[model samples]
Target: MTRRTMVFLAGFVAVAIFILGSIFYTKPAPDFAQGIGPGGDSVLVRPHSPILGPETANVTVTEFFDPMCETCREFFPLVEEIIGDHQGKVRVVLRYATFHPGSEDAVRILEAARRQNKFESVLFVLLEKQSEWAAHGEPNIARAWELAGEAGLDLPKAKTDALSPEVDRVIQQDLADAKSAGVSKTPTFFVNGKPLLSFGKQQLYDMVLAEVGQ
Candidate 1:
């Protein structure tokens, strides 16, 4: 073939290859929904889940988190900041994924704290002191109860309440719900039922901002 003809043929082949790649290329599918998850209202939030911020807020951010999760401890401050920025337009629902070894005991303590109307206080205090109680190799669960006491929880009652059947039911149901919602790790967050497009502080912020904008 002539040099000019050969060049034209090569260009045509390249274009065809590009078209084929476009047709057959398989990229990882993003699980995030453009709006929110289907049936999110029912799937994401359980009735007894711990809530932060105003219930009347226009947007809901559901977090599937483990009490012992280091990342949960890290992002909590950012979660607070994002909620504050929304100016009463947002609320957070806490769903326990409880993937870590000793996270269940911590979750039970927080649940008992809820009975005393000190859930938020105890939660914050425990999260703040998480490292001391939630060490990697050896968990110090009693330290969590001590923190709960300081957070205004009735210590004796809390210890009993943590083992109540109601608390056990809540923990089990949350685990089931987390699995149903496709949560396989700690700190899985959904804004208005939509999973964060990926894991990052900025990504979470952006996702919440997008929901708020809508």
Candidate 2:
């Protein structure tokens, strides 16, 4: 082939390859209306789920999270900010996944704090000091307990309540629901019953905004 023809052919091949790669590698967004897995609304939100806004909100953001999950900790503030931006229109319901080592103990501690109306406070503390207590290998659950106490939990009472049948029931129910919801990640989020399949800070915010009609 002539030099000019060869150059043109090579450019055409490169463009074709690029287009084919885009089609094959790009992930299509999940269907929002159909939702994911079984149990439907029952698995998305529960009576025992920790809520962060008015119960009557039109938009519900259900998050399946593990306390010891690094990404969960990072996204905590983002979730809170989204709720704050929407005022009473958006609320977040937290369901435990507890996939990390020693995370069940953290879940128990948070549930215990719930009995005293200190769930949010203790949860904040735990996430803030997560690296210290939720470190890999051997987690320092004792330090987590101490942190919960410092976060205004009644140490003696919280320790006892953490192991109660009620707390165990909460853990079991959430795990079952997470499975039913097909949640395989530490921080799976569903906005208005639509799974956040795109999975990004901006994507989550956009999903919530779309549901909020903003």
- Global lDDT of model 1: 0.85
lDDT of 2 by residue, 1-214 (tens): 8999999999999999999998889665443333222223467777677888877788888899999999999999999999899898988889999888899999999999999999999999999889889988788999999999899999898889999999999899999988877889979998877788788999999989998994
**lDDT against the true structure, each candidate:** 0.85, 0.86
Q: Candidate 2: which pairs clash?
A: none
After superposition, candidate 1 runs with Cα above 4 Å error: 1-41
Candidate 2 deviates by what RMSD?
6.7
TM-score of 1: 0.82
* Residue 132, candidate 1: C-alpha displacement in angstroms: 1.1
Q: Residue 69 in candidate 1 has what lDDT? A: 92
Residue pairs whose backbone atoms clash in candidate 1 = none
Tens digits of lDDT, candidate 1, 41-63: 46577678787887777788889
